[model samples]
Each structure stands twice: as C-alpha cells, then as structure tokens.
Target: MLWTITIACLLLAGLIFRQSFRKRNEEIEMAGDAGLAILEFGRAFPGEAIRAVISTANGRTVFLRLHDGKAGCMNAHGHHYSCHLIEPGMVHVTGAGPKRLNVKFSNAAFEGGMFEFRDEKEAAEVSLWLLGSFMPGLAAQNPRIVGQPG
Candidate 1:
C-alpha cells in the first residue's frame, strides 16, 4: 500500500509540471505570433522591423522598431492592436522612475494611457528615442497648418 501511494504521488507531480510547462510554451508562441503580425502589417513604417517588445503585467504590449535610423512605436491590446508613426505632437513623457516610465499620447485612442517599462534604463532609452528622434522627425514632415491667420 505504501509503494502504491508513493508512486501515485510522483505521477501526479510529473503531470502538474508538464501542464505548467505547456502553458508557458503557449504564451511564448502567442507572443512570437503577435510580433510577426505587427511586422507584416506595419507597412506605414516601411523598411522597419521590430527591434524590441515591452509587455506590461496588465497584458498590454508595445513594439519598438526603427526605419532609416528613426524610431516608431506600436501598441497592442489583447487581440486588437494598432501601429502609429511617432509624430512630434502625438506622444509626451508624463512621469519617470528607476523602474517605471509613463508616456501619454495626444491623438491616439490610447491617449492618457501610460506605458510601463521594467526599469529606468529601458524607459529612458525609449523616451530619448521618441523625444529626440521620432517626434522631431515627424514634425519636420508635417504639412503647413491650414486656414488660420497669416
């Protein structure tokens, strides 16, 4: 009776471990597929490829990519997502910390939403790219303002 009980316990433990491993693999696969879809549909960002992906604990994901030496960002929320060119007037930094960074979008549906990074280094890096490179370039490309006083 003792041997039978021990053997059953071992088998149950092995089964639980296998299940957990499978779940982790599924999550990884989902993330990879999500990244690929973003890349394929990101035609507005010609010649760009996903360089990094940041995921939040609350299930939001952001993709960073570069094209012709400029940076752009894309946001994915669960099964629905959108990509945008980082225009000068579109994004702004709202908060900062060693383990957190907050940015707000002006024209995006995600306006007022804060993007959380794992650490200050990552946050700073992204902020600099957005502010120093992306936004400025976006402004340079903008057409003249319409219909206001000369």
Candidate 2:
C-alpha cells in the first residue's frame, strides 16, 4: 500500500515539473521577442546603447544613450529640452537627462511602441517626408527649445 502511494506522488510531481518547465520556456520566448523589437528600433542609433525596463504601468520603458561626436540640442539649449511621447492618459514622460530618459506607461493602456527611422543621411535629406510619421502633433503645440549661442 505504501509503495503504491509513493508511486502516485512521484507521478504527480513529474506532471507539475513538466508544466513548470513549459511555462518557463514560454516566458523566455516572450522576453526574446520583446528584445528583438527593441533592437530593431535601436538600429537608429547604430553603435549607441539602448536599455529598457519593464514598467509598473505595463509599458516597456526605453532609455536611449547616443554618444556620437556631434553636439546635441539638450546641452546647447538653455531653453530646456522636454518631450511628452504620449498625451494625457496612457504614457507619461517622467524625466530626461543628458544621457538618460525615463518614461512610464500602462501595459494595458500603452498605445505606442517603437520609433523607426531610416539611416541618418537619407533621413536628414528627406526629413520632410518623415516629419509627421514619428511623433504627430507634438511640435505644433510645444514651444521650440532654442540652442544657446556659440
């Protein structure tokens, strides 16, 4: 009788283990897909570093750090560079820095994903074509942050 009970317990344990393993595999695959999506967007910065953290709000928060030699609008501008990627409800632009920025969004409420732009040269040459594609209605309402005189 004891031997039969032991065998039943072992079988139950094996089934639980298999289910746990399958769930872990699915989680890993989902993470890999998310990373791939970010990498495709990070291509805009080329060799630059991009990082993301899962936000409490359900949006994957991304921080892009670009270290090219050229000057940037943030440092040169006393006007203070700021942006709101999403409007009043879903995503909030919590912070921005010289090398880092923070954003939070509700995963269920997240309405935006990645930003894709062509290579730098082509993007610069025909920016007018792509101007309204990335962030629509943003520039029109916000005051321009002018750079300080050299």
- Compare the candidates by TM-score and give the number of the best one: 1
* lDDT (tens digit, per residue) of candidate 1 on 1-150: 999999999999999999999987766655446455465447656656555555443334554635433456555544445666565567677565565557777774554456667667767767666665434444335533211244
Report the poorest 10 consecutive residues by lDDT, candidate 1: 139-148
> Candidate 2: deviation at residue 9, Å?
0.2
- Model 2, position 123: C-alpha lDDT score: 25
Q: Score candidate 2 by TM-score against the native.
A: 0.34
Which lDDT tens digits does candidate 2 get at residues 46-93?
A: 544332222111122222222221110011012121212222234433
Q: What is the number of backbone collisions in each predicted candidate, taken in the order shown? A: 1, 3
List candidate 1 segments past 4 Å from native: 1-25, 32-38, 41-44, 47-59, 68-70, 109-112, 138-150
